[model samples]
Target chain A: MTKRPRYFNLEPIMNPKSIAVIGASDNPDKIGHVILANNVASGFRGAIYPININASGTIMGYTAYKSILDVKEKVDLAVVAVPAEVVPKVVEECGRAGVRGIIVVSGGFSEVGRKDLQDKVTRSGMKYNIPIIGPNCLGVTDSYSKIDTLFLPAAKIDKPVVGGVSFASQSGAVGSSVLDMIDNEGFGLARFISYGNAAVVDEVDILNYLADDEKTKVIVFYIEGVQRGKEFIEAAKRAALKKPIVVSKGGMTDEGAKAAHSHTAALAGSHQAYEAVFKQFGFIMADDIQELLNLSKIFETQPLPKGRRIAILTNGGGTGVLATDALYEHGLQIAEMSKKTVESLRKVMPPIVNVRLPLDMAGDAEKTRFEAALAAFEADPKIDAIIAIALFQTPGADENVAAKLVEYGTKMRKPMVVVSPGGSYTKRQRQIIEKGGVPVYESPGEAAKALAALASYAEYRDSHVKKSR
Target chain B: MALVEYFEAERLLKKYKIRSVESRYVKSAEEAEKFSAGGRIVLKAVSGKALHKSKSGLVVAGISGGEIGKAYSALERRAAKYRPYRILAQKMVHGGIEIIIGGSEDVQFGKMILLGLGGIYVEAFKDFALRVCPINMEEALSMIRQLRSRKIIAPDRASEKMVAELILKAARMYQGGRMKELDLNPIIIHDGTYDAVDIRMIK
Candidate 1:
């Protein structure tokens, strides 16, 4: 329990009641048209006011206005998709109109060596006390509020169903791709924000806003660079007390730094410094986009484990060994089953099966055997979490095994996962288990890493609570 | 960039309460011999002009009282190109865990401190961990815990606490914001405390 500060009011940005889409266009090819169409088609319940320079005409079947000032109704947010040069003046006008939030989709700011224009936008935002998302960004998409501002087309990229994970991405490229992937992964997403250039609103504001957001269970960031190091650290540290924060930072190498500079006009800070801040502050670092997805799946669904001890129930013996190694590498321990539990599992399972930490139930173990082993693991107080390496390729392992894992996921209080690797058959079974809310990792190593991340966060939250005391 | 004089670096380290091994400045070989009377001695060349002390063969160790004069002359001839050079002599710290702690400016993050394995291993292994500066004691301990070779320093938990406290104390000098870099390498770890054997700074 850390209380969020009153500063950086960004409530209206994510859940605005009435939104005005500036530069609304009839031409479908224009980005403004795409953004306007996204709002028109989405589940947004708010009034969509299309603002074009003409002021008298209609666009997207909605009444178009010459300017936001001319609109009589109260506008909670304005999405500006005009040219770069006119951005500052448009934002100033939005401020005068009493717009609570503004998302500028127009580019040609600092990313293109146009800091002068970017500074003007920053000044206007400050003058009006209006929080502008970006002069060059994809803006925000809140699934709960149905407020869609990202310029990406709705048909081409399916938006993820509403869930608890909220994201703040500095790069629109990464943001859009992840949005697409999250949909494919079938996990729900609460909000998605792409704050490009970060001229007025930065990563810090996003972190602070999401920290207190009840809908967001986890906050993830895709950062190529950050605007303020100290402020970012302080905000993130405050946020992590409530929920886990996962970070995937690009531009670690010298060459990558240069590319990042040109991409976002950001001074990609020293990698080691950022690395240290994340580690000491209890922020989970994802090595790549895949890992980011892996961590997000677990944090989004599972409860924090009681301890670091994890038990593995695998159909394949080899996968169990690999998972154990991965567990050790991540500073997690293999849970030793209690003597009584092991004895019961030994009697129920085949004679060839080894009743130990991994408790490998040979390749042909049926769904019943899997369930029996899991029951023992769940009953044993020593096992804080469980990983089931249910390879679908085996004869005895079928859809029943996937269903068993899903049933465990639904019924058990402890965190659990499934690691299934194969061709199309295994992939289908994994998707089935995943859709049922049990995270199914492709490899045993991924399963271990996800569990490790959960444990680290649990450890951090416990320590942080103790520290406050 | 020029390296700060050794005495000034030590003085700043002292002003901020960063522990360091006691050493006396010596200008000539005879004075260096007198300082090494008790035990084995470690010698370091101190000069703004001396960019690479070890590469220039300006540092020598394990010199007895009789051998101090000969070692000092050889160092003097080796460092002849560096016209304005001085020497500091201190009794050797014996075999202790060699570690490095540093605080410097990161272009984007402002001030940051790094802790790592020292001596030749630091370059060969690069086993290091760092955090933004003005960190608390808890953060300093966390930094040590993140190290890959933390077991070497964990022979005594009290020793880890000492190094963690040392990091906090040394951070004050860096907080002054004048130093471009402050590197205390080969800080010998003892039971409850440690000795900073080499202090290097660039201002």
Candidate 2:
């Protein structure tokens, strides 16, 4: 049997032991200068080489090389942030210096209809068998490796802590915004790559790399279009079997497709086609960036539900109804409690509370009532997952509710998600629930959606495993 | 791009073991009369370049055997504006749901197969399912179930299998690089049997 050819070996590009920042500027406002400062500040353990033509001495306290060729040491990676016209020559010189990876952070190529210039840089990299990340992009970051190449200043965009979720995006602006959003929300990341104007490496290459990455447990993609559909599907299918992949496609509408074309020269083909592919490959398709983050956080922290039957436990009747509706909308069933379980629930529950699927515990229910309800549901054979909504505003509910949920979430085999929606107190409760190793969402709808993602992944995994057998 | 005439398109479909309604190309009224003796027939003007035959008055359907001569002359006169024209005589098939099976080369993704409810459903709702080429029978059946009009085939497992097989065959043919686009519109299915009534191929 013939072995398949590897299109990308992204280790050197993503986790380089030694890096050279070409076009490194002393000015704080320049993109090159910001990228260099970020690398130094982020505490990269590898050797850093700053290349500049006019500067002679140290830049940001690191020895500067006048040219990449002048550097006698072996350079594993080159960060090119020069003018677009000079990128091709710089890439050719890097190729001669035997660099393994190149990341060009210039914007004048391809996105502005300058294909020739992009092609020149691409050919130079190809001639030396070096993979290029972008012609116009913010570059990459590996939180575990402390490799931060993004041009945005640290004051402007906060770097997330190292975690299990990694992301690959096609647009630099959107990628940076999402990074900031996830950081603000206290979600951590393992790796991030924004390959804008993908002249060489695309999402498929990055996805393949992340699939085998040891630290990453969930892969996220914010893609506008795919250039090579067959390769992408193959890579995504392989990755999805081992871990969950959450994707939010950008151009689902005709108008958005047109906009995506000018943005990255992406041919956003028929939306129906994309939908079909996503369904067939078992990829969790998020409708927006917020949902993408929500799904990612859940996938990273929770186990997949063995089945789709979910039991919703909420203190508020209105929130319970909304949770039921959202669960049904996502094709998850509200578990019909057994007669025995309902009999046990009727003993402790108030008469006003309904002992049905969305087991409303009533607003005045205390912590023990919540624990008893959760214990009854956890013992029931029919329930595969639980979405517990804790309304912190109620007088009877206290911070101990979060602790009870954490106990059940960690002790039980079934996956559990919490919904704590409200003002400052609720936000603080959410953080406590999250810190205890359970995903917490602001809305019942988001909690339901996250559970649905888990159930859908389980179904996909089952179908694929059966096929392989 | 090259156009494949109706007769040629049906020939390709038949070669792939997909059943197509029996059709014969004739240059004269006598040949049309001979081919239409079994039952009512559909007369269409055959030109590689001309599409939308019904809208252009190039198609006359539901013609009995006795009306072959008159229908053939009417179609000939209507197609006078189109060059290198002939007539296709096809047996009028009935009593089956209308479904479309097609394959096209996407710009980003290579070959892909499309399945949807044919006739007005495809034009009005645009409800369709697509998959990359070389799909298996199980994958093809899953695509059919993905359609919004899935209830139409919910109870008929045999019909579902036949539709799935037809899609797979079309996708395999497309992957061979012989054609860029292929359409089998209004494929009639009843009692677990399917017939490709109309075919168009763009090479």
Candidate 3:
């Protein structure tokens, strides 16, 4: 558990070989007890030690040590759940024991106007050359590696299944709610980190770490403010070059900036400055929470689009019109179908079908209609992406149509998204499509925005490369 | 909060390869007429307190060499309460769209360059684009594209290229940390080239 200079791997901090639960209590009301119980239930692939100063016997069926220094085995990570006033002493003891990393989940630090205590904790970590996550944060959750340090009970915030998208936030409430919705989104997770107050390990470190994380294919962030602007700009540039980074900045308005400053003691930069940086560095920015999640899932599921040209195929005529407006609004072009593609589709589709850019297959379209239109659009070299509006509530759309959409939308050559918003029947069908590795948005606007973001990222990478072809 | 004198600001802009309107500090009314050189010139009162000099009618424009004395006296009278620092006579430039280019150090980020529709409508419209500096050509072009009223300038490839060049120069001028802010407002974009009509810097 020794610290290495420059080449120190953060792997042990997140996916450690062993951990210790400081302040592990028997009372359910205490946060320490809930965190210890979660470690047991999360099936973390490591040894767990319980440390309590007052405990005389085993706590939670594991041997209890009075202090972290008294623990025999090497403590790779220490999850500190104690009073804010006592955190500095406990952390100093953990530092003396050569703990590799620490996550202080207690609140009542700088957010409550106690900057002196937070500074003491920071100083102790610096003296020992050890990294710390927070003094007021929920810590991190790695779904695949199974290192769950979130203090909330398991029943309250359901864990998302394992996948490629990784999320990092600056607030616990937002992180916990997003984690619960990750499962509902039918998108799995790689890691979810909440560095509230960010006493030591700030957003720049997390950005650099995930840039090299092999399990993470796309990174999402919910940041209230950024203090270290130069380092953040450089780190964000490095990470975005490797994978798509979708960011949702919380404090944009004057009112929100004031609240953010009080919430995390963050010095929120001007909204114009943040917007300029996000655009210049190629980080896909979202307007709201839903757009943030919507933009992220598409990058994880689909291949990069070639250009801004998109072809819309829909079972409903009105949905086709809406998709057109949205595509233009998002700066996407309605692709001009090739003559051969149009001729081929006309031979197969009924006369009721309008064989054009917005290929409305009508309300009575079945599985074969979707299959034909998707195949035509997929084969057209002019079309860079496809948007399939599959209304399962329609009379002719059934389970077979759902299965066919999954097949077409999941193709690796061209990027495709399905817009299917409905009641229970549609929701069940959406599950099937998402299960087969296709992303589904609820509305035409969302679907268009997702595809537009995908196309823009691809275009940026194409032009921003350093090497000449 | 002290402003760099107007002549010094123009010299700095010219040193960074940004073409700016020529002006001279006239200590007397006779010097004002001589600086005009029988062409259309503008008269302005210079002072650290005259931040919004143009808005306060401290500037009198399009006066020939014969009327330069009258314009200079009128500007001096309006700017007297502010304890005017100097009287300036500048070449009156016209015949192009106005663009406002600026550079300032942000609190979190370092030096950044800004571009917007210049003149009185600048504050009312607030249509602008900004980027951190040491900006490249592609970035400058992107900034130009972000302007909402870019079409109002009837922008062509030549004009856009010049604007981007002006932005790069602004970035260079604001570098080295000696100055705080650089504003080149109402830069007149003529057919061949552009002239920075007004230059203001703060330190």
Candidate 4:
């Protein structure tokens, strides 16, 4: 039997006491130098190192260790930011120095198609029994602890309140974009991981870990492909029933499919086969990044839908029609308005406004119209969730919109999604919406998808809960 | 793929330990009548490309000595037009469930085994489960349990152990990789005994 490394808890690296940067450079422009600077900038409480040879005693005020072997302190994690050729040697020294974890941020090992070097790295890591994060990767971060060793240039703000959404991405760029969008939406992130090249660890291992993570209520993955098909299916099956595991598989297109095969050396299964597997295992598959984040926000905040019925509230007829089209395309229904809801809507809606299923407020541009529309839908028993497209047309309309909707939404015990389509809206308006604690999406598709995803989760949650009961 | 000749297909299935109907090739009705004296017989045109011999009136079931000549004459005329130009007479095996098992090599996933609700509805219902090859007994059992027609394995209908064994044997044959395709229809399960009423194996 091939002996594999025992799975160890990796929470420390994300919340480490000290981190030593191997191959730290004096050149601020390079990855090695920038990583050390980021650690200082991000307020990492741990120790930072700028390991250099024949240089000044300090690179950036931290004592320069010639190598990890020379450092006296016990290093919790080592950030290797050197050339691929020299990474193995650096890893060997770190292993000898008793480093618990190493994040090899450098590329050109496996990504560049060098198996010999990859083998050496893998074998040494196994021999020393160290959990190597990546030979090519963006390192992990715990937003809750403010521990970010990621290579991204500009990082987002500190995390929000502890919630259960953790992100795992195949591409670091995509992951950074997701974090920025999540931050913009004012959603708290539990953890963000980019498994670059996945030379040592894979998506399945991270999913298995996240399945039991107390802070992780949901797992959102951006998977390009899987190494083992059966193992992946089994892991997805087990995890989906336990927690809401959403995936946005890149390479859905033909060109992307070619890139996926070369990048991961995985047989990207037929698209139909993938859909079947996803359905069988109850995994929510998203089409794009926007949808992934949109679903993430909804699953993070609201209760799952008990049924497919939806109530759409809008300010313009054209926008309402567009939302209707989207609902039909997405397999959602425009809820039939209850008599009381229609009666209440008619009181505020202009005679010209179509106040049937959508509860259109027309171009009245009145805050009361908006509030009345939301309230009427909130009172409707048939509606499971609400999608409100409030694009700022009339002045003073955008203000207090999100707050008012949030208040009514909380009262009704349903998610009220707000989205602002294209056009330059002031930052203040956006903040007003986000500050109201209603998740703001930038597109109608995002809001609609959020509701759909929430409903999917709710179905799973309800069944599991009922089963337990 | 052409339909496999019944007798020729059975020879291949016997290599894989799959049971088939007791059959024999006969040139004339006299040989068929003498061979099937103890019981009724089924006279079928032995053409590999022929499908639905009964629908074409090329097959006659429950034939006795008096009707054997008539049935054989009709089958021989059908066989003349049929590409194979042969006739097969066999005892009509009865009892058991009609579960279908087949194997095909999927391009991306390699060898795959398909177990489905059997009989003509196999294609109509299209209800099946697929698994990549070199499957263990546990994996085979999992596939069988996952099928939509899995209720066929319930005790009221068929013996569970017997059905499980039939599936496991097919999986082993797939693992052996000597054959390209194997389909067993109406794998009769009576009490606990099972036999393949009709089988087709192709490479």
Candidate 5:
């Protein structure tokens, strides 16, 4: 007589009609008070519960309740921010109150090396068919719904509807950084989830759920390890065939490997074996956070690359050479310009500019040269993708020129990634390029990696496409 | 790249019809003398550590009748200098191409059959190719193609069918998983016929 734990859609918490914030406190820094504040700011519609044992009145302007049993209406989601030992009891009470989902924001379960507490939480969820997100987790956010289940400060802009990129992370800090990357780098996100510790709910279940999520067309994950490799691989393969699934695994060194094993008990086997597995499952391996963002932007915007050949359009010799080196290091061939592509470029490019492989145009006064190179590569049938490296050397190096080139590159529908390196003022250039629906990177290595990932996606698409045909 | 003594290695190769250099295990000087008197002979220590008998003063080649006793005492002294060992008297096989055929189990692909140019040059050049076992003629041919210095397969050097057949036989032996490894180095090819000079098998 034991019951199995039931899992449900994330929609209940993500789009709840009513939410009960248990352990709501008077102190602003307290977990309960922060949870209430986030809920209020997030604009959750329906009844709210401020559960407190000895509060004199309301907290955060919400009517206070003595307990979950004191809440009058049916609760769809419950946010638990209580002491470690009392969490299982609170979860049991929430279950009895018919809460559909619970986001446990406490940290003393499996995360603190307490399997006993973890078991209690698990049993409570099983008894009531409740879907618990975490025992030690920074919650989720649905920007469209104005839901900020997390306590982190919100960005000062519209929640981007840039479709198709959802992020999943094992580390909450990395997840926060991803949100900041979205705001700062303009890489759009569809949804974000940080399942810390993953004692009750692990990566496989979340990935399985995301597999059916309509909003998620591309999923980026930062995983230290996986508890179930075969299950994860199967789910990833199924998800990746339809959409790109990119992973940046964090444990390559011995110390990191040991940490990874203790964290999730993942084999974290040979790094090469992991790489081979990624190749077999058709998942792109991102080397860094910037590269990760760049790849996501590409998947959001252009068609997958058709080949590994790349054309570079730059305003400076150093930038062009660096871009070429990165492209080559990632096993991409320098694209040979076609006769028609060269003809188009010859019209706008300065005579002194060499329209060769990198199409390194003249430095400084290279606005025309930059546009000319972009035009050529966009029209070139041989080129699979293009990396446009724009440097902010002088005022004549108009940012608009780079942005327009990006527009044309997007119009061509070939994979084009931009590398814009400068101080804070280059925001306009970056925003324009991104708004034109093209991927951009801050460094040449990031841009090249993005292109490489795009090429991998294209290769996978080609094989599957050909097979289907 | 490690070698097992001649008597032990020949036992494994014979199972695959890859005959070895004609040799006899001799417990005493009488047996060694009888083997040497039969034909052109090469006397060696049979202990595993006594790999290069010539270097260890354990080998006396091309000797006739009464020479076997003197060679045995010299080999015993050299071998006893390090550890105890046995003596093997084998026929001196000359006039052939020295090639190596062996296998080491690969961690990823499981048991792999290895083939390359044999003798001391094998280590010098590090020329080798490996294929996962249960190999047929086609896989055997591919291994030959994977060699770093593949010119060893030239028409003047080796007969195509003979080398291919030998590789396939070795692959089959490994694929069975009954044996752990097989190293038949310096497998001599004479007048278009292949003969294993030495073989090492571990299970």
Candidate 6:
């Protein structure tokens, strides 16, 4: 087991009891106004104090103080949305006012080649022992705490429901976009943090905090670069032992490195180095945003598959073939069903249906066929996981297949993923399957990929546990 | 970066308990002949600046005692562009899988160890796996297994263990931080025994 050092406790920043919004303004176009409005509309239970130099009247239903110094009550966190040049002075003032944490939502610091100014802001935090989240970031959102510091309006970026998955990103735009996309996909989030520029609190610190956060079951990251490689690996390794971690890194190519650096002042080192580190720590390295979300959702809902032997149960032959190809591509095996399982499947499946590994039950496979196939796979000792392709576009298939999947998925105690791809009809079925606590994907390949992620995590956990023992 | 000479790198590998083929450095053709009297030998011209010796005609293999003198003169003349070079007489090793093990200090991840297939087709295949230094035996074995040609080593458990141990040793040596980069290409492995035939190091 790797020994974990005492990381900076981020409770004050993530779960603050009292939060002060700096640069608060009455102008709706201002970032400060949107951020203050978001906090208020999000129903943050904490005491909200708005700080503005000139404004004396109420702002966003909260009385605006002249400055942070004027606020008489104790402030656990200060969300600063001021301009770039004034950020360092504001940080110093926040530090002097005994703020425990500060989230600098304003841009323009090291990202714009102003290293000296960024250093001054960082120094202020260090001198006062207060952690700073970012100098160029969207800030954080904790659904559990009802703290939404993101300046993006709720209308444009809908908040996801409170759930077990938490994400920490180095890019604000990517983080916000993913959050919005997840809301549309019916995936929920426990916490979301976009720590751009990472002047003080970086991905490593957030990962450590989320490792112990009760609400966060699976931790995800959108990393452009790592400031402290060794520390990040250690923290990630520890976190992964307790909960699954999926990472999608930017700046993999040479051209992307330049953009990453300009966007977040990230180092953007060689991709091979990051790959090795991820493999060493047993992290699920997702190739894109969608894959990251897919892996996170699977890890959040499904138990890790005991082995790699997967039984593909699909209604469409094409989907089955695609799932088979994806399973092989991901290094997962297509299980050879036992004779007993084949006999059981033979009793329910039609004569035309081949009792093979990817048992394609034709387009007419309805709820009964799915139930029979699920039962056979559940009883088969050779099959460790199942990927059920429930295509709702088929006329004979019904929504009851989702209920059957839930029943069998729980009874089997094995990981199961569903691929229900199509238009409105399939989307409705997918929502039904999702509500039944089964992860649903738009394609067979994605379903197979999710199973692969689960199998890989299981193998990694098993190996690590054996080694520790 | 400062390059370490071939003989110096061999000595360093030996000091770290990594097996290297025995070789003697000679300045003259007569010394080459004297060193190549035992068996078939490989004659190589040692120059710090010359990286691709075989491509430059500075390396001659399968040189018996009689051919040592001619090979030595040819190599010295071929390497005349980079003057002030010595000749190395190494016993010819045969019939082994060519493998490459290396390590370099990455700017972000610190020291990283690399394992891959070697020989002339190394560039064409580009099959390799990398891991951070100070890796355990399990990690080293996984690095070997990650290669596309893993089947070649799967049947021979002894060879697998040797390759894994070699990687771990190289990672340890790299973690010492003396050399900025090290390459032990074409490490021949036959019947579970291995020998590092060529070495390169940059400080």
Best by DockQ: 1
Off by over 4 Å in 3: A1-9, A254-269, A467-469, B28-39, B65-70
Residue-wise C-alpha lDDT for candidate 6, range B39-148, written one tens digit per residue: 78888887766666676788899887677777777787788897777778788897888888887665677888888787664667777788877799889999898999
lDDT of every model, 2 decimals: 0.83, 0.82, 0.83, 0.70, 0.71, 0.83
What CAPRI grade goes to candidate 6? acceptable
* Model 5: share of true interface contacts reproduced: 0.00
Query: Candidate 1 lDDT, tens digit per residue, A1-469?
Result: 1222324678888999999999988889988898888887787899999998965678978999999999999999999999998888888899899999999989999889999998887887777777889877899999888888887866788778788899889889999999899966757899899999887788888888999999999999999877777788788778889999999999888542432201011222377767777877789999998899899989988889999899998888889999999889888899888988989998899888878878889989998999999899889999999989988889999899889889998688899988888999888888888888888788888888989999989998998888987
Positional deviation of A464 in candidate 2, in angstroms? 1.8
Provide the lDDT at A203 for model 3.
84
**How many angstroms is residue A391 displaced in model 3 relative to the true structure, after the best TM-score fit?**
2.1
> Which regions of candidate 2 fall more than 4 Å away from where they truly are?
A1-5, A253-272, B26-39, B63-73
Model 3 chain B, poorest ten-residue lDDT window?
B175-184
TM-score for each model: 0.93, 0.91, 0.94, 0.70, 0.70, 0.93
Measured against the native two-chain assembly using Cα atoms, what DockQ does each of the candidate structures obtain, in the order listed? 0.43, 0.33, 0.39, 0.07, 0.07, 0.40
Cα RMSD (angstroms) for every candidate in the order listed = 4.2, 4.2, 3.7, 8.5, 8.2, 4.2
Per residue, candidate 4 scores C-alpha lDDT tens digits across A1-469 of 1354434356656667788887777786878787788778767776776686554688888789788888888888888888898988888888898988778888887667797787777776677777777778888877666667676666344344445689999888888788777766656689888878766667777887788787887799998776656666667757887788888887765432432201011122254345445645667888888778667766676666657788877776777777877777666888887888777777777778777867566655567777888877777888878888776765536666656766765556777777666556635565566655566777677677677767766675665456657
Ranking by DockQ: 1, 6, 3, 2, 5, 4
- The lowest-lDDT stretch of 10 consecutive residues in candidate 3 chain A is A259-268
Query: What lDDT tens digits, residue by residue, belong to model 3 across residues A1-469?
Result: 2332332245667788899989898888888898888888888868888899898788899888899999888999999999999999999999999899899999999999999889878787777777788889998888876888887877777678899999999988888888888877778899888889977778888888888999999999999888688888988877887899999998777442432201011122377778888888889999988888888889989999888989999889899999999999988989999998999999999987778879889899999888988888889999999998999989989889989988887764999998999999999999999877788989999999899899888877777765223
Cα miss at A154, model 4 (Å)?
2.6
The residue-by-residue lDDT of candidate 6 on A109-197, one tens digit each, is 89889988898887887778787899899899998888888988777766688788999999988998899887656567999999999
Better of 3 and 6 by DockQ: 6
**CA shift at A161, candidate 1, in angstroms?**
1.4
Q: Which should have the higher TM-score, number 2 or number 5?
A: 2
Measured on C-alpha atoms, candidate 5 has an lDDT of 0.71
Please provide, for model 2 over B1-203, each residue's C-alpha lDDT reduced to its tens digit, 9 standing for 90 to 100: 66686766776777788899889888788887778785888888866546656657888888886788888887888898886778888888867788877776656666778888875466676667888767888788888888888778444777677778788887777677488777777787765687888777777
